[model samples]
Target: MEFTEYGFPPDYLDEISSAVQKNDIRDLIEEGLIKAKPIKGTSRARARKADAQRAKGRRKGQGSRREAPTRGTPRSTAG
Candidate 1:
């Protein structure tokens, strides 16, 4: 069969035998004929930096307070 018919270049099929079997791709991978690319992991550098800033009291401000200091009570100046 022409290599172009299978979307492969002519030179690419030159190294492989024309009598290649129709085995499953996973079988080829298990037999070490083919390999899959490694998966990438998410980076935590930004998160760690933010945590360090918070630990140093960098992000603590009025907006971060859980409640007001007076708790909505009216203070008497004389008392």
Candidate 2:
């Protein structure tokens, strides 16, 4: 099968074909032809968990208070 059939980048086709013809299994392994074990969870699940944790840490009213601007300076505002 052509490398493009396996969804590999077209530029890597020559190297991939050479490796296969040379019996260089390392490249195949790196390309995930051989599975070691199934991942426990989907990447989407992991990403969601990470995003939730980050959102929790960014909860409103969590950080040090800024000093109120003195009368002369313009107060900075959020959009």
Candidate 3:
């Protein structure tokens, strides 16, 4: 059977023969010939560094402030 008959494109192969049968494909997979690619983990280098700096109180300065400072109550003098 044509490999494309199963919805796979002509070039979408994982090192297996293009003219293989379904049972043959299963056999190859069972025998460790057809292996799936491993999933990649997200990198936390920058995030971990930021967390470490935050633990050391490095990012709490006024320059990094998010809110405006509150004002004290006003006082008035009467005549």
Candidate 4:
């Protein structure tokens, strides 16, 4: 995918563009013109959202809103 296809920071885009003759950042990094910046804990925004979701404990897999009647707990199975 082209870097232009997605939103990239202006400075990052500039570094990527000037890093190598290729438009792809991966290729530039491979060529050693641009060094990949290490991600700080999955990034600021993503980390925030991930931490919030983790605090909420929504992915415990206990149950979902679409609970089905397993063993006749008073449910109509005739659809």
lDDT (Cα, tens digit) per residue for candidate 2, span 1-79: 3334445556655655677543575756677543355446756887787679768874333253355435335567422
lDDT of 3 by residue, 1-79 (tens): 2335443335536646653788877876675555565566999999999989999989987777777454232445322
Query: Per-residue error at 10 for model 3, in Å?
Result: 20
Top of the candidates by lDDT: 3
> On a 0 to 100 scale, what is the lDDT of residue 42 in model 2?
50
- For all predictions, the C-alpha RMSD in Å is 9.1, 12.3, 9.9, 10.3
TM per candidate comes to 0.45, 0.25, 0.49, 0.22
Candidate 3 backbone collisions, by pair: none
- Name the candidate, 2 or 3, with the larger lDDT value: 3
Error of 3 at 38 (Å): 1.6
Off by over 4 Å in 2: 1-3, 21-23, 31-79
Give the clashing residue pairs of candidate 1, or none: none
Q: Is candidate 1 or candidate 3 better by TM-score?
A: 3
Q: Which stretches of candidate 3 lie over 4 Å from their true place?
A: 1-15, 62-79
Candidate 2: give the clashing pairs: none
Tens-place lDDT per residue, model 1, 1-79, is: 2335444446544433442566654454455444454566899999999899999988787676688676545686323
Candidate 2 lDDT at 65 equals 34
